[model samples]
Target: MRKTEGLLKLLSLCLLAGVLVAGVLFPVVGAAGVASNQASETVDSMSSELATDPPPLVTNVTDSAGNVIATLYKQYRIPTAANQINDAMKWALISTEDRRFYDHKGVDWKGTIRAAISNQTGGDTQGASTLTQQYVKNYLINVVNRENPLGQEKAQEQTIARKLKEARIAIQLETKMPKDQILAGYLNVVEFSHQIYGVGAAAKAYFNTTPDKLTVPQAALLAGMVNNPIMYDPWRKPDNAMHRRNLVIDRMVDNKKLAPADAERLKTEPLGVVEKAPDKPASNCVGAGPENGFFCQYVVDYLLQHGMSEDELFTGGYTIKTTMDQRANDEAKKSAEAQVKKNQPNVANTLSLVKPGKERHEVVALAANRDYGLDKDRGQTTYPLPSGVTNVTGAGSSFKIFTAAAALKQGVAGINSTIQVPNFHISQVFTGGGDQCPPKDRYTRTYCVSNATEGGSGAMSLQTALATSPNTAFVILEEQAGMGPVVEMASKLGLRNSMAGNAATGGPVDPDNENAQFRTSQTAWYGPSDNSPGKGSFTLGVSPVSGLEMANVAATIMSGGVWCPPTPIASITDRDGKPVPYKEPACEQVVDEGLANSLAVGMSKDDMPGGTSHAAAAAARWTRPMIGKTGTTQNNGSAAFVGATPQLAGAAMVFRPDSPNGGLYDRGPGNVVAARGTNGDMFGGKTPARTWFGAVSKILEGQPELPLPPLDPRYDRVGRR
Candidate 1:
């Protein structure tokens, strides 16, 4: 009887202490209620608030095909046998947060009183949270909701009304949802740092394993992260996170949830942080650099801006079929590189002429190269200067390819038409200039004719002139055809911007403009006219062009006038392997098959013995046949080449910008710097050709090289003869 009475007194004291702790921790009372009388009312009010609002609805994720990727919820309800939510979260939370959770109906009055006494006496720290209360807080309450990118914002720490509300919600949830569901929800919605939102993501992120694969120690560590996700991020700060995890394990052992031996073993266990590559593409491919695949990059940029995603590019698994064969594209780059290297040494030296401090080395080199001849390390020679000059511009001679096409299209010239080269000149009526004279001047030298009326000449068929790339001969033809037909033809050939015979610096050739500075007569055929002022003959290229744009244009020509947008990926399928809709294959013809063939055949002369491209002509040694062209601009020391096998086509060009460098000073400035330089010159036939050859040879290892088709039989020399 005496022992029983003493036990009863101990129980009464514990209960009293719990109540006092609760009173001090949460003192707010309901209206019209005095202390103890209002306790139930306060609890009821809290419960009602929690019941009124549930968590927000989560968003769904999808795949490229618009198929359901994942139906995301804060918590996953699936239950695993051994890896049950109870074992994973462990008993640490229950003992530390809620000692009497299972024993109490909804609230633990005894624990609450014990906590109150501890607070008053300063004997032990006190907190009134039950297991259910903590669970509710983890999943339902907004207590841990963060407002910053990182979860450093503190939640409202003290709230009587909030605590009361938490209690009510806990009871309601326990009554409404199954025990397993409540546990699952809490685990699914918990935050573990580094954007990991659920137990599954956290498991994979921290341990490189799944929830079902976690050990007791790993589980305990995860449980400790609930209080502070960042400070306890296992992968980032393992030492701190491990300490917290060990604390939880200690608590579980004290509460009898874990064996003493197991606890001791777990304490010494090494933490293993899983290594996971980010779920994005590796950013170190050819697509990521300045020297990326120039042609490929342009196509990709166009597709992206016009409408396409990175996913579609790499993983969509679509097959992209282009007009040009990959083998051909490779050949083009190799040939260009090889051709450019041969002349680069000379060009580089000319560019380096001026000493570093002599002026800007490049400027002096450029000015020096333009004025006098360059003495190459190999040998010294003076080269011819191109017509009227200033700074380098696009190649004017090569621009005639389009001119010839336009003339043929307008019926002004036929492949067999023969014209005499004379003092070819365009009158003011033709040039739109204030005065007109035979397009002849002091600068006029190569290919200039005195006059049809004066003593001068060279007679050749239109095909022959195109084959030889003659300037004076074409100017006479241009005068006979008139500018209107020529201008219209240029537009059809895809020339968006035009240049009049005379135009201001940077002005497009506008026929309607009465006054133009670029105006030149028949002599302008080879390049810039002698009298007109400008610079290097980069004009032989007709202005700068990107490798990609040129590639596409060449594709159109090679495809017999068909142009199509380039695509890297062939297709995109859903997670379940369903196909998605995208742009259908688009192709359109831009030229007549005959015209393309004519141009191809004409360009082939460079490979013939009396032709300009002797080095490329050496392909005669190989089993396959190749065709190429050599181009040099007068004013600017620039060189260019374009070539194609039946399977591929590409263009490559090299020119000094503004001035030469310290290296090339020994060379005279301008085209003169490279004038005496021959097919062996740096720009025209060497480096660019080598690059094109190397790239193509590798790609065409096992492939057969085919010859181009003949031009229209009606215009063939054999037929005419």
Candidate 2:
């Protein structure tokens, strides 16, 4: 009986021992279960969040033909798929990172235990994390950085809690994603170096090859970089990279993925790293290639000003197809460079081309001689647009077309309307007929107009006056047409003042003035204003106007009075190849078609003998019929030529930025005459005209001749008729 009682006591003690062990293990199992649940929830939440918002992608700007012109990116990552990756690369990565990747669900308990023992024993550290766990950690870090930047430090902290969360999330991820897909996502997002992420980017950056083209050694090198990219950057530390690469090869051999002989051969071989400098993608127009910089910048400015979201432009992977003609842009650059070479280095020139069409008014080419940059010494800003080196120069006599249009629109005069040619005119209040000077000091009678020369006299047809660009005759027409109508015509034709008020009207409305009601109609000039000289001389192109606007004006006439606002973009698409809606061209009929055609006819006369731009037309010798006007600002401070065929309208300008009010004639370096004229001074009909002709000649190459509309016979009167 005593023996039986002792055996029972021993059995009870054994039972107690079993219960203690069970008690110890139960909490661990429960804790693991709770942790796993938390991870699953976290992963579910993360997956939901990611489904709604993907990472920012690089935006690409392409030409009309879909050739990539520029790339814009916030992070230089180009994701690649798992199937697209080379077998060698996949094996190398798997062998180096997690040999048992296929066997484990998410956490490698055996490897983790081994790593824990190694850590305690002060042995070489081994990464116990599986590929999925690593991906989960990276995903968590990315989410934390994106959603809660302030918690990034805590997210990256090497703590037990973080590891447990990673393992749990990894398990959830394994259940939700295919193993190959998880590998692809991890490969795509893993950072290989500064500004370089993903196997695709790293492949291109280091070997100048695609992921699928990566050789065994190259793949091994890249796979090894995931541990510490900075330390093993092949470009910076070739020796360290070589050593790490060999280690990867050794691991691949041990994993039985690579033949022993092949592995040894690759280990002895050079890294074969072909270091290609990553293309630091340009974010703005200023960084576009030299030939495309200014034009690109113009597009950027246009989009930004037209309500495009700035963030979207930089990171939304938008595909913008611009209207820029690569051929025209190239020719324009050559022409501008040739013209700029003839003047002082500081002298800036601009050329703008616009295609006139019923569907869209496209700015085909915008080119300047210099590159776009921040250096003031070298012109950076696009010359045609307002910049430190350029502002709106007076449109000069090119403003006469507006006056001519106004007269025709108001029926105040026709092409046959006659005005006796005179050396000058001083008037108090303009009456369409003759110059009438009011008594001196009347403030209202302040009109003084003069011609460039004194020659033709007595009853010249208005057409002849315009062809000759007679300042006195246009001023007379402006008086006859009434300043209100003349100003209205200019405004409707897309003239914008860079100053505070309308370009046509000098400034803000004077509440006390009788014409306060008229202020609403005058808003088209584009630059800072000089004090308004209340006189008819305004028709002489005294107001500051950009070349772009001038080109638009010419294009309007070319379009037979239909004003299509200038646009540089042809189409825009999102990253997913979906079209994004944008504003269509704002079209308006600004003048009578017949009136515009008649004015075009008169302007074409400038290409005839004795016309203002006749010399320029002769120089161009275009196969197609062309019409153009020459403009010389008062004191010869600026010179311009605006011309057009039925297909295209363009403007060219030459001005001194420092001494804008000073003459462009004989003022260039070495007394180089910028505007060749009769009196050894620059004239609008000379250099500006020649430059426009040169540029147009190249632009019209291979283009079929299209004639302007026939002149309305109602106003076909000629000189002295």
Candidate 3:
């Protein structure tokens, strides 16, 4: 070419020297306004972000014993220390990206001039940016302006201004961070895939190995990806990636880090990446597996419900230590799935547990028959079956305990007080829709109710009534106790979702919901369906309910009547290992400790020979001295059982949520509510009880069997208050 002009010739000479690079170097004379105050600020801000901290690392969800169940990330990154990376990786990067990396001060001026002249002379397109400059570019896109599209576009814009800014920032970074740290950060922050990032994460993801254990070929392949990850992604373009990887090997040989013979030999080696990456980051609860998926979701929802944003959870690099007992969760999951197959579209079995403590109640598990996922055709669902009031979920007679609490509080009936129950009750006192009552009683909506069992309705104490789950007896007692007190007690004892009507959706208020018409607090469970005050079936558990809250109800009783929020996370730590403070509802004494102790004593007969769950308990071979109650809705639409020891409390519930019309508990034949493709013999005393026994027993194994607190004699008689 003829003699180059003023700027071009002068720039060429200075570029080859690599001396006075970005420091003593003169700015481009013709490139006016390229180094504005805004550009200076950009360089300074980016250098500060890098010098202070690296990019965001992955946030992990760990079970009680420290097993990672889930990973949440805006980018799949696991920042490792500079010294931790394999030397092979360092060599591979230095050889391929910048052979004069150590010699240059951030900008490879010689390479830059060569690239410019070659491109102008009809040569192949080439990049001249050194490792530090490349690191600055990636940091801007992935870390500083990760979520800002315009900022990312500006970062990658092909303009002299952009190059000048990057060169300036890279020089600043070289001055601040150690070379090793800069390299390590670049390796950590670089993207390997949309969901795979960092050498630490990418090593494990691609080869199921750690950074320190990476082989030379593996390092070469990864280093090559820095140039064009999209065009050479091994999954999408294995052949292209292989050719680029071999090129990296050749560069290593040229750098004298690898022998020519070895380079040629290694070039013939397979890409050797695993067919698919293992432990690849999956963003949501779906990655936590089928059973722990429910627990994972609970952790996410609980955090989001309590003021945590989705972006913070995914990108804030928090280590979420959940309270879930993995063993208990695994056992509970197996038990629940054993009851109803996951593929049983019409049937769902769910369980949740709360560990009872004086100060806190930790949710140990939230499990269901259905796998927690997004695929609907494969019979998967994200429904909060274990924690929310999904569908019209009624707990049947299990709610008798709530009425019992109210009765004990109001002094209407005590543990030892006797109430005679007939086969059916014609409630002259309370009135609501009574369509399930005998045809003669249905016309008056007189709140008529009957016993589910045959021939055992005689005079019985309150404790015996609970064990037998006598519906008519509880209805009469509820009438005597009053409606508002029973509903209030249920809420106080942990039936929060059932009481709120909208708490299931995580919002406490919805103006368009029935909350507008009903006294907001009483709308869900206590309010009148026909614009009246009393829910005739309140004591019968004839309302939507949450299995987790029900388990908390049992935990409330077990914790000396202290109602605590069923919190899933035990603790949260930030990237620096500093504790992140989180506050949940405080534990409060919702009922007299004496009354709860006495109720525990009264409900202990549930697994005995004469009690409703006796047969199922016997089948489970259970002998733990614990208190429990079973409930079955009319037509067997749903069944549930709440059980507890001094250590822990849990609830199991079964329903056919898929069958909309009835989700009926069709007892084999003669019931129109029979769900499709079911054995149709579901009851609280059957699958619910069996699942409860199977799961809770395993969790309670090896723990000391603490006896229930002594019954307060004041709770032995009627009308104490």
Models 1 onward score TM values of 0.51, 0.79, 0.88
Give lDDT for model 3.
0.80
Candidate 3 residue lDDT tens string, 23-114: 31423421355356676676668787888866877789999988899998878887788988988999999999988888887787767767
lDDT of 2 at 338: 66
Candidate achieving the largest lDDT = 3
C-alpha positional error of residue 322 in candidate 3 after TM-score superposition, expressed in Å: 2.6
Instruction: State the lDDT of candidate 2 residue by residue for 1-721, as single tens digits.
Output: 9999878866765554444333323324545663355545665676444323455566787777777777776566666877889888888889989988888876776676566456545688776889887876665555336346657666566665565556655665676777888788778767776667678878876777899999889999999999888899887888998999999999999999999999988888888766454444555665567677777777776777677876678767788999889988778777766656523444556678899876678988876655556565555543434221143346688888888887777676778777666776775454222245544454434556667787758568877877788787777777677776777778777664322233223345454564322233353221112443234656777655667777888888888888987788999998788998865547888787877788888787787888888776777784567778888776666777888899888887766554554444444323224433333234567766777777888878887988788788665643211
Which 10-residue window of candidate 3 scores lowest in summed lDDT? 668-677
lDDT of candidate 2 at residue 624, scale 0 to 100: 68
Compared with the true structure, all predictions reach lDDT values of 0.46, 0.69, 0.80
lDDT of 2 at 383: 41
Candidate 3 residue-wise lDDT at 351: 92
Q: Which 10-residue span in candidate 1 carries the lowest summed lDDT?
A: 358-367
Q: Stretches of candidate 2 above 4 Å error?
A: 1-45, 49-54, 106-130, 133-172, 279-287, 342-344, 373-390, 427-447, 456-459, 482-484, 496-537, 657-682, 713-721
lDDT of model number 1: 0.46
Candidate 1 regions exceeding 4 Å error are 1-238, 241-296, 309-398, 416-468, 471-539, 574-577, 583-585, 617-623, 634-638, 655-682, 713-721
Ranking by TM-score: 3, 2, 1
